[model samples]
Target: MLSFRMLAPALIALALCGTGPASAQSFTDTQRGDIEVIVRNYLIAHPEVLEEAMNELSKRQAAAEAAKHEAAITQNADTIFNSPRGVTLGNKDGDVTFVEFFDYNCGYCKRAMTDMLDLMKSDPKLKVVLKEFPVLSQGSIEAAQVAVAARMQDASGKKYLDFHQKLLGGRGQADKARALAAAKDAGFDMARIEKDMASPEAKATIEENFKLAESMGMNGTPSYVIGKQVVVGAIGLDGLKEKISAARCGKATC
Candidate 1:
C-alpha cells in the first residue's frame, strides 16, 4: 500500500485532474483512468508556463517601446523647428511658428498649401517655416531647385508660398521644364531663374533641408513638426491649426 504522505500527493493530483471535487471527493477505477489521461494530456499540451510568461512579457515590452517613442517626440519640440535651415513666414517675431516639410510633387502638400495661405492671412502673429523635402522622385528635385531659385530672386514670402502652391497643385510631373514654366507664370525671370538654379547656395540650401528632414525622421513628403509633436502625413488644415495653437502655449521652437 502507498504511504499516507505519498498518497496525499497522488490524491491532490487526482483532484486537479477532476477525478472528483475536493469537497467529499471519491473516484472509481474508470474515473481514475480518465483523470490520469486528462492530467497527462494537459501536461503535454501546456508543458511550459515560462513560455506563456515570456509572451506576456514581450507584449508589455512592445507597449513600453511605443510609449517611449511618443515621449521622445514630445520632448523634441525645440530641436526640430529651430534648426538653421528652418524658414520663417507670417510674423518674423510671431508667437507661433509652424514648420512644414514638403515635396513639390506631393498632392496632399498642394492641398495643404491653401490652408497655409489662409492661416497666414488670418493670423499675422503666425510664423510659418517651409522645409523642402523632395523625396518623391527625380522630378521633385528639379522642382525644388526652381522653387529655391525663385526664392533667390528677392521675392516676398507670399510669392514663395504661391509658387509652392501652384507647383504642387498642378497635374503631371514637375520636371525641369515644367518647373521653369511655373516660375515664369509666377512672374519670375525665366533666364536668370534657370541660371541661378545651379548655384552652390541653392544646392547647399536643399542639402541642408534634406539633412534636417533626415534628423527629424521625416521620411515622407508632408510631415509637420508642431511644438513637441512630430505629425506625419497630411492631417488637413484644422489639424494643423490645432497643432499650431497648442505649440503656441507649450513649445514654439519645434
Candidate 2:
C-alpha cells in the first residue's frame, strides 16, 4: 500500500517514460487508470499538498522577481533617484530617497499620496521623488504634461506638488483642464505654464520617464523604489515606513 505522496513521483516517471501516443503507450489502460486513481485519491485525502506546492512555487517566483528587480534598480539608479526630471518632495539632501512613479488618474496613486505626505511629515530627513507616469488614458497623459510644465516653470517643484495634490484630491476625472485649473490655483504663472506645456523640454522629460518605467519593468501606476526594494502598488504608511527605516539602518524598525 504505497502512500499517495510516495506514488506521485512514480506516476510522473511512468508518464515520462511512456514510448508513444495516448492510444499506444508503454502502460496499459488499466495501469494508467490505477495511476490516475492513486493521484486522485491522494489529492482527495491530502489537499494540503497542493497548497504547499503552490506556496513553494509562489516563493520561488517572488525570489526570482526580486533578484531581477534588484538588477534593474542598480542599472537605472541615476534615472531612478537622481534624475532632474523627477519632482522632489522632501529634504533635498536626505540620507534615504523614496521614489514614486504615478499617474494622476490612477485611483491607487491618489490614495497613496496620503501615505507619501504622512511619511514626509514624519521623516524630516527623507527624500521623496515623484515621477509622472501617465499610462491610464489620454487625459492622464494630458495631466502629466501640465505637471511637467508646472515643474519647469519653477525648478523648485513647489508649485508642482501643490498642483498634484489639488488635482489628485479633486473630484471627477483628472484631465488637462482639471490639471490646468489646479495649476492656476497653485499660483503658477498660467501664461508660462500653457506656453511651456507644448515645449520640447516638457515632452522630452515625460518620454524619459516612460523609458525609465519601461526599463524598470513598471507597467502600472503608483510603483515605488525605496532603498534597494522595488515595491508596486499602495503599500500604505507602515509598509513605506518600514522600507524607509530598513534603508536607513538594517532592520525594518530603526
Candidate 3:
C-alpha cells in the first residue's frame, strides 16, 4: 500500500496537468519538480483538502450522470411511460409514472415486488409499468417469454400480475416450466400460452425492453425511471417512496 507521502507528488502533478498539456509543457523539469514539492508539502500538511477535493469530484460526477439520465428520459418519454410493450398497472391516468425493468430471476426484484404491490394498493394516483428485462440467465429469457405470452392473453393485467407475483415470489429458479405453472395457477390458457410464447410479439416485446433499458444505461434488474430521474438499483421501499414523492409533488412526501 502506497502511503500519502508516496502518492502526493503524482496526485499534485496530475491535478496540474489536468488543465492542459500546454501548461505542463510550459514548465521546465526543474520548475515542475519544485511545484510538485510545494503542492505535495501543502497537501500533506492539510490532508483535509484531499477529502474536500474528492467530495467535489463525486458531486460533479453525480450531476453529470443525472444530466445524462434526464436527457435520455426526455428523448424516450413517449415509449418509456406509455409504450404498449410494457404492462401498465395502478392508476392509468396517474400524474406520476413509475417504470421498472426487471428479470424474473433477480433476487432484488423478487424483494422489490412487494414495494410495487404496496404502492399500487396505497397510492391510487401512481402509474406503475413493468417491463421484462431478462438479462440474468437463459432461464430468465424463457420465463420472460412465457410472461409476455401471458400478458398477450390477458390485457386486463390482472392475471398477468398474479402470474408475476407467483413466479417472482416463488422459491426456486424461474424457467419456462415454472412460468407455465404460474400461468396455469393464475388460470391462463396453457395452450394459448404455449402458442403465443412462440409468436413474434413475445420476441418483439423482450427486444423492445432491452432497447429501452440500454437507452437509459440500465444494466441491472429493478432499475427504475421515476419522473425525470433514473434510479439504478433497488433502493428499498422508503427510498422508492421518496423518489415517487419527489416526482409526484416536488418533495420527499406528498
In Å, residue 137's CA in model 3 sits off its true spot by 0.6
Residue 145 displacement in candidate 2 (angstroms)? 0.7
Number of the top-ranking candidate, with lDDT as the measure: 3
lDDT of 1 by residue, 49-83 (tens): 43674688789997775465456555554555555
- True-structure RMSD for candidate 1: 12.2
Per-model TM-score versus the true fold: 0.66, 0.84, 0.92
Compared with the true structure, the alpha-carbon lDDT of candidate 1 equals 0.72
Candidate 2 structure quality by residue, lDDT tens digits, 7-103: 5766556555655465446677687778778777877898887778768879999999989888988998988899888898799999999999999
Model 1, 86: alpha-carbon shift in Å? 4.9
Residue 154 lDDT (model 3): 84
Give model 3's TM-score versus the native structure.
0.92
**Candidate 1: lDDT of 53?**
48
lDDT for each of the candidates?
0.72, 0.87, 0.92
Ranking by lDDT: 3, 2, 1
What range of 10 consecutive residues in model 1 has the weakest lDDT sum? 1-10
